[model samples]
Target: MAESRSKLVIVGIGDDGLAGMTESARRIVAEAEVILGAPAMLSLLDGLSGRKEALEPDMPAALRQVREALASQRAVLVSGGDPLFYGVARYLCDRLGKDQFEVIPHVSSMQLAFARVKESWEDAYLTSLAGRPLEAVVDRIRTAEKVGLFSSDEHPPNRLARALLDRGIDYFRAYVCENLGSPDERVTQAELTDLASMDFDPLNVLILIRKPNRPDQASRAGRHRLFGNPDDMFAQTLPKRGLITQAEVRSIALAQLDIRPDSVVWDIGAGSGSVAIEAAQLAYQGMVYAVEPEPADVALIEANAESFGVPNVRPVPGRAPEVLASLPDPDAIFVGGTGRQVVLVLRSAYARLCPGGRMAVNVVTIDGLATALETLKNLTSEVQVWNISIARGIEQMDRVRFEAINPTFLLAVTKTPDVSD
Candidate 1:
């Protein structure tokens, strides 16, 4: 009798029940002396000789039952759709050693939901609401192109839609897919506002597709502008005027950063967040952290971010080196208004920047410029410095006179592939 193999079989079934399972999976389920599943999953099958156990809510009790059953008889654990995809199979396998069981998967409900809506989910953000906070999930969905959510009674589609709407995220078209793979399956499409007040079946997948070209509509003034817009174009703080970076220097610094569409950037000592805002625009698909210690400056950054409709720029309030510890590592960093601690901040940022990333610093004093240049030279061989002096034309009665703007120095460097190099 080959010593009676004691393998436990885990099969993924669907609303279609036995008809949905493969021949091998069906045979495994039929031969079992004991089976475990949620009440809805167990209700799908009939006329089986196995003793069925309801596995919802009281999972620990069900696991104990499965363990006792496996001691003397063949056991099978049934689940809806792919058992490995946000299902109980992973938990079971983790608790009951991998060698003791065999897993067979079916098409996941997320896959079915996308298929029903005729959309590709190759890059969709997919997650289950069973144990996640609604706010955290909504924040993740803010910039997603497509999202698939496994909703529970506690966090249903309507509740999720209302949360999203409250966050000013109304750019996605909503789809509620119910009873997937069953004869009475339904997929309902509606705008986010409409979906916020509607009801859905307990067994449903929520799909959100971002409206076509809607994400950028808030910021697209005319033609796609990446960086180096006029300095006056940004909202500056009152009374602390003339502190923003000039357009000429901003252009040079931006070119030096060599930002990609998805590059992560940090603008340290962000005064009124002009550089940070422009960097945010250039790195539209990525995130930009504007680290400013002053409360007023932090407020200005947020106001400017809203006015420009750039959602990716986050205004961080705190002193540097300490604050930088909490922020994500950056592909590029821009330091301005470092006061007398220019070298300290520069060294801290340099230590955290990713390899091949760039840093650009603006200085008006000779002492600040010298310190930055010296520290950057020790980090990499690809260091460049430029002295930017601009002159604006003023129309007189008979002629145009050019008045020179104050001179500023910009020091830019690229980190080596490794510290040893």
Candidate 2:
């Protein structure tokens, strides 16, 4: 009768091989009657009496050897990094059974790559190109702040870079970490265009960190809406971030403004410049002034402006009413809010609005809305009022959730031509 097989041991090896493995892994390899691993991994086993077996190209062939060896001999299989992390161990365990294997994990190359780059991986979008389709990978990477990919021979760093570039996803800085845990280890950092034009070792980990405040380098296909982008798409000021004009209300307010190609617009209390930036897109031939009191918010406005590639938007730092003096009288104006002085700011801003120009105000509180209504009514007999309540759909698991945005009111009025002397 054949001897009963004990559990097969799967040890994760690194580029450094034997010297880098733990004592337990070394001892397990020493005692094994049959060992299986890639040619490079098997070459690391020195001074061992165990029968070394090179892995077959296919999983079934490798499984046959493991099963046959385990019947009369102790079996060991080696893989690079954590065997279950986009490695061979997962397939073997899934094909056979969990009870048949003991897995000893090593640091995955993705983890090592991020460590080499000195960046955090907690929020990174990580995956292996060895199994994923390149098109799917690029789509996932479009909005990611950081990404890590295990580059395979078929989809090496250069090939993957070309794929990204062809799709116009060029906003990230790329790092290719090669031969991790080995003396010949090299980390090459460059722009995606440079990476696409260069070559790299097949044994490499590719990492990408998105540039600050960058919008998608290329436009999404079928995306025709030029304004009122989702709120998260814009860079906002912290602590008071939710102050952004909601996309729904922004669209409505912009419509009310009746902006023209040469319309000079003002976004008072710009609050990270969402309104100002979109308005700038509308008035590309014109100019949009983004006014804010907070210095930090002003910085965000500038960053957001450049990120959106709208040089026409100007971020003016100072409170409204006072700063309004420096700006050219606007053909259109959007008042996000001006604290307790919403009424006061509106009065001053309306005074400078061009004849037949339009102005829109966004107010969140009922009391503030009331104050705006009275103020605007005094300025013009005609006012357009809208109560905007929005909820974004968020799908989790199989169920869907509607995230409600705070309901807000918009007051828009046109400065009557006769009254505008």
Q: Going through the candidates in order, what is the number of backbone clashes in each?
A: 0, 0
TM-score of 1: 0.59
Model 1 global lDDT (CA atoms, 0 to 1): 0.83
Q: Write the per-residue lDDT of candidate 2 for residues 181-261, one digit (tens) a residue.
A: 999999999998899888887789999999998897654433424698988888875677677888888888888999986
Scored by lDDT, the top model is 2
The whole-model lDDT of each prediction reads: 0.83, 0.84
In model 2, how large is the Cα lDDT of residue 221?
35
lDDT score at residue 248, model 1, on the 0-100 scale:
81
- Lowest lDDT sum, 10 consecutive residues, model 1, at 216-225
- Model 2 TM-score is 0.52
Instruction: Kindly list the per-residue Cα lDDT of model 1 for residues 1-421, writing each as its tens digit.
Output: 5566587778999899999889999998998888888889999989899989887565456667767766756888899999989898776675556667788998998999999999999999888887454544676688799999999988999999898887688999999999999999999999989998899889999999998887622223344256777777777777877878887888889889988866789999998888888887777656789999989989989998887767778999987877887776688999987766777888999987877789999999888788888888876776789988889999999999998888999998887655232
Best by TM-score: 1
